[model samples]
Target: EKADGIFILGQNPGTNHPRMLTTLERAKENGAKIVALNPMPESGLMHVVNPNPQEYDNILTYPVKMLLNRGTALNDLWLPVRINGDMPALRGIMKEMLAEEERSPGSVFDREFIERQTVGFEAFVEHLRATDWEDILTGSGLTRDQIRAGAQIAMHCKRIICCWAMGLTQHKNAVATIQEVMNFLLLGGHIGRPGAGPCPVRGHSNVQGDRTMGICEHMSDAFMEKLGREFNFAPPKEHGTDTVETIKHMADGRIRFFLGLGGNFLAAAPDTEYTARALQSCRLTAHVSTKLNRSHLVTGEIALILPCLGRSEIDRQESGEQFVTVEDSMGIINPSRGHLEPASKHLRSEPAIVAGLAKATLANRTTVDWNDLIANYDRIRDHIERVVPGFENFNARVRGEIFYLPNAARDKRQFNNVEGKAKFVISEMDLHKLEPGQYLMMTVRSHDQFNTTIYGLNDRYRGIYNGRRVVFMNPEDVKDAGLEQGQFVDLTSCYREEERVARHFMVAPFNIPRGCTATYFPEANVLVPINSTADRSNTPTSKSVVIRVRPSTRTAEAVNELRRNIDEVRSESASSRSPTRQS
Candidate 1:
């Protein structure tokens, strides 16, 4: 399990995970080659200072500290990939690797491993071999030499880790692109090995845990049967609505009640204006939250705000005190305890609120003991242990530092596919084609924001100050469009014969690829259509949007008025300076 090379795809660790920079720095010092493939250059990947105080003191002057603590350069090679070009770039690398395998048979690929543990390898290889170089170059915005350099690194490394995030997953070809990445790793027998695998970094903490705890609408029949057996009641096996379906239902006036646990749905969801209208169409909307957000302000006919205790606040019940178990990205179950007292006496824990709602709604229809579960969290864990697999002795196992959930692929090198082996998937090369005068746009978060929360207006890492209503564009593209720095423009997105506009945003020149632009959302969420989603995943295609920029009408009118006022002042000054003989 020795890893000598690491490839980061579509993630900006600097702003997203500041603490991970130190880990990357250490990896680089240990003779590991780090390659960063992103659309924009990130500060965290460029250079990172060790945050540990023992490594360097923080009391020194800024310049002195910089010299004394010369940080580690995280990225050895940075590939500025075009927006939504992840699939093409991965295909290009795989194509190069296939060529090398052809030249030196069995040197670049694992023939024995493919034959023994994988299926459909021949078809996958054929697809890569037949990939067009012209499409690769155009879609990836990289030359043949660049792709070859990346393949060479992969060929030389005995073990490698491929990491990706939302950047590659928020597109129409999101699922297909990820399969391509896995195919690249499997070409050299990277699966079921130490330090060699695919790592899809989760955007938020406990997201995987939420899915594991049956938070999704599409739960498997096995899980539902287990849950029904454990709870002594028949559970619904029908698939529930996803985000897109929920929005559509809400818009059609079918969904009467809307309940949100802990999210700024209005700001986070795509097609902000449409989502807002849909929410307004609901009969009643309710939210369980710690603080007020934009969703709270935009409500339905009858709205209710249920104040809940924050994760950091003490959750006290009739029994005494309690703690919640949350699973991390790597399947590590850890108990999270809050040291601080509750912010308000009226605030209730999430579980208590849900239990109260269920007890009131169900009345005497169900046999489930909501009161008992709310009194002690151990009872909930016990039920979970009985219902969910790999969670045996949940209460006892979650007490120590951490406990890992069972992962067959990682532990036993066993694939849980239909054929009981890893399957090599073949996907089509689908690239988003843009029309003339339209640029590929994507929504991004500013440095001062986390998800939908806005802490400040400035993004210091990207050199953006005093603004969130600004679009980042390539300098050459900006100049070619006859636009100047700080010029105001209106962005309009056309999808399914419908147009959505976000007005009056200033342009900032950046180092992004040509015909691509980036803007911060939920401001830009207005431009995203609710209908535009990924094929299989049904995820919002927020990362690859086609939008046109036009000069702002208000800015143009203001400029004209200012020029007329300046001329009037000039004429007045000339008249005042005239001689007495002329008068």
Candidate 2:
């Protein structure tokens, strides 16, 4: 239960979770070893200034920059694994650990826990023993000694927490890679203990909650039965469309109506050009949002922008003012009350909009009281309590500051699997196959932006200023590709005999692994193939794209020609409209 070691993989908590820096700082001060594994070095993991002055400063100051530079050191070891090489790197570490265990026999691994709390240990061990070292070294861009060093850390630590994010999940072998991570944990008996488990940091808030509340296209029969019983309606048993499927359906003219409750789907989705075309193919599209985004600009034939109340704005219903409950990553539900006034008087809450739309669409066909549900939020909560598991007494429990939804795996070492114990999954090592002139490119968010919203042009953490259309490549790769820093190049992705090109992006030499490059999206989303997605998850393979970087050729000339044609057309129109000129 002791938190002696913390391993972060593929996440930059410094920029993403800036507030958690202080917690990490304290954890480090308490002698916790922090190891960060990523393809590119993140500033947050390198160093972070404690925002709270009481921890470092004696006097309180406004603006906070005066005391911003003082904070705790982060990341005792930073492993620059190749893009999509997390599976191999982790396997390498486990291999080294197994080697150590073979030498000393029960010194490195918890054999007792393996026998009691786990199944398939013998098979997993045999697989690990049979794995070739050469393949591991090649898949991971690390030497044997580097992998050994990481293995030594895992072997010595009593408690270890493995954290990862989209970097490890947006690949073809994403599920397998994560299962490998779990295999590593289960081997060392790292899960179900204090300060030791898997922590998958989601990009946004309430993502896990959304899934728990049956927001996914795929719902279990049990959930559907409960929903039908509560609502007195027969729910559809067929599977629904996911993001990729939705795009495909739209492109094929199968889907006509597209309604987005929230999120900038166009900017956040992959294959930007294709996704845009799919959206335009729809007969009608509606978006409920607080502010305008890129998705509003790219629309279908009939588009409606339904401005909704923000989380910070008061929601006045027929009963009285109401509050919405949001669940965090940790399954903790909390009531979110808005103290500020609405941005606009015409804006409606999300619930109100949905209810109104349902009433208009259904007319008198359904027995559901849409207007009554909107009258008071408690009615909605009561309905959710009856339908959704772990949400019993949802209205009453949410009145408190926080309530934790029951998590069997988190609360106890309970795993509802085939063997009733944690299973050791065997996964194949499938790395990206790159050609001579191609590099593996991964899309990342800039420090200046949150997801697709750009707050500023500067990526202050990476020292990039005044731009977002810049690719970060290894210096050696830049030289090998015959490109210089600040040079404009076109990034072209070739997949399934189709090539998509993003034009005129500046190349910046960075400390990434050889043959691997990183670029910020949705600027580079055009290079991602719509068909290239993770198996099972169906998430776009944003972290593993084979792309060729070439110098820009005829794009400038094409733009100049188009501008000249526009000017000539304008001149001709003016001449035709002149008073002295007659037709």
Candidate 3:
């Protein structure tokens, strides 16, 4: 809300993050310029409403507040860049800004900040100058004028914030693309300033918290040293397996026991069939969950569904009703106090379950007492304070209304590097070329769903109602492919000569770029190749899948099966509507 300008890229804060719209709306009202750069035009950026009634608490006053907070326009500029074209677009903007600085020195670039707090400026300028505009223009699928417009916005604003999400990640050069974003911000010295920084909107709640508690494939050496000193045991020097690595290990029969804390492993993971096979290979697969989902259906030889308390359900531990602390996306720790009663007395908390498992597996191998740790939730915070930096007096300070964790780059404007300064990155733009019948397919979550949990079949953001098995494509692309609206089609992805098919996706023409299509995830996760992943992160490239869209080739038996289902539903509906129907 305090920023002079906001650049939102590769994320739809409206449907995915509706809470952010109020801030954007407030920023707009404050006369802040907002720029949206994404493959699809978002409704939230264009139009947003603050649902919170400021003064209207009752029926009479509610109308007054509603009438006052009608709506707000959130975007002053929008650039519709194609998928995987973010690198070129970002580079193009930087190139324009560099030229602007040359045209009128001292008015554009932050020379003092670049000279003192940053390094590699001269090399970065030379690289930018040596770059060809043809590649930037072609790869970005944008015109020079459009690119210059975005540059103009950056040039005018002193304090700017750049925000991005999964759209920038999940590619071959995900890390490089992010570096490009950092480089862009560094030019204007956006970091370590109020209302100015790189905001990476997390995909799920408490994921940042998970990383803070040392739940990562590769733990930092500093964290490992602290944990070792605290526990009186040397932590493993070798790095553990990530999601993709775990899947591969499971498939190789190296990992027999599989346990999932949360999330639908089969549905959310890339290559649905491969992931299912990997899960099936496991001897025992246990999941700590609140409710049943698709993962429960696709179980291993011996599956265990250990039902646990939901976030809202009260956790009555041995130490009385306990409240667990969770870290938000902003790195602020807050207590989660559940008010609702437990659904069942047998249900246990996630911490308790993990504690029990630890006690059983490592009986006397360690000196740590699992029971004592799980007794009171405050004890966990105490331990975290001792080990994790910036968490001193966690139990006392966490009770406050607002608390922000320490960030060196954002707080002190200090860069902890070999050179003791931030360096500008030079990233290459590698655009994915399409074949004759190929389209760049990316999976997206609908408004009605949170990850794999579907609340309804409708996606109100895209005007999709009562159905999820539909693809959002350009109308021109549909016509070019000789396919009409509402036509059923099958999406097939071929990697390393191995093909995977997702059947019967209805075409829904939308405002998307040519040669690019968007499909709802879990339904389209099958098309994401396991072999195709982001470079450094080793994360599955879900946002950059190459696929061929062809007419739905349903067998006669499959057509008969569909007819049977429809007939069964119609008959049930007719029977319920009969006059003799009992209440």
Best of the candidates, lDDT: 3
lDDT of 1: 0.83
**Candidate 2, run of 10 with poorest lDDT:** 574-583
lDDT of 1 at 64: 60
Model 2 C-alpha lDDT per residue in residues 398-442, reported as the tens digit of each score: 886688887666678788887778899988898667889999999
Q: lDDT by residue for model 1 over 275-329, one digit each (tens)? A: 9999999999999887767799888999999988877778898898999987766
If both were scored by TM-score, which would come out higher, candidate 2 or candidate 3?
3
Q: What's the count of clashing pairs in each model shown? A: 1, 0, 0
Q: How would the candidate models be sorted by lDDT, starting from the highest? A: 3, 1, 2
lDDT of 3 by residue, 244-285 (tens): 989999999999989999777888899999999999999999
Give RMSD to native, each candidate. Answer: 9.8, 7.2, 4.7
Using TM-score as the measure, name the better of candidate 1 and candidate 3. 3
The lDDT for every candidate, in the order shown, is 0.83, 0.83, 0.84
Compute each candidate's TM-score over C-alphas. 0.92, 0.92, 0.93
* Alpha-carbon shift of residue 278 in model 3 (angstroms): 0.2
Give residue 67's error in model 2 in angstroms.
4.3
lDDT of 2 at 210: 81
Q: For model 3, what is the C-alpha lDDT against the true structure?
A: 0.84
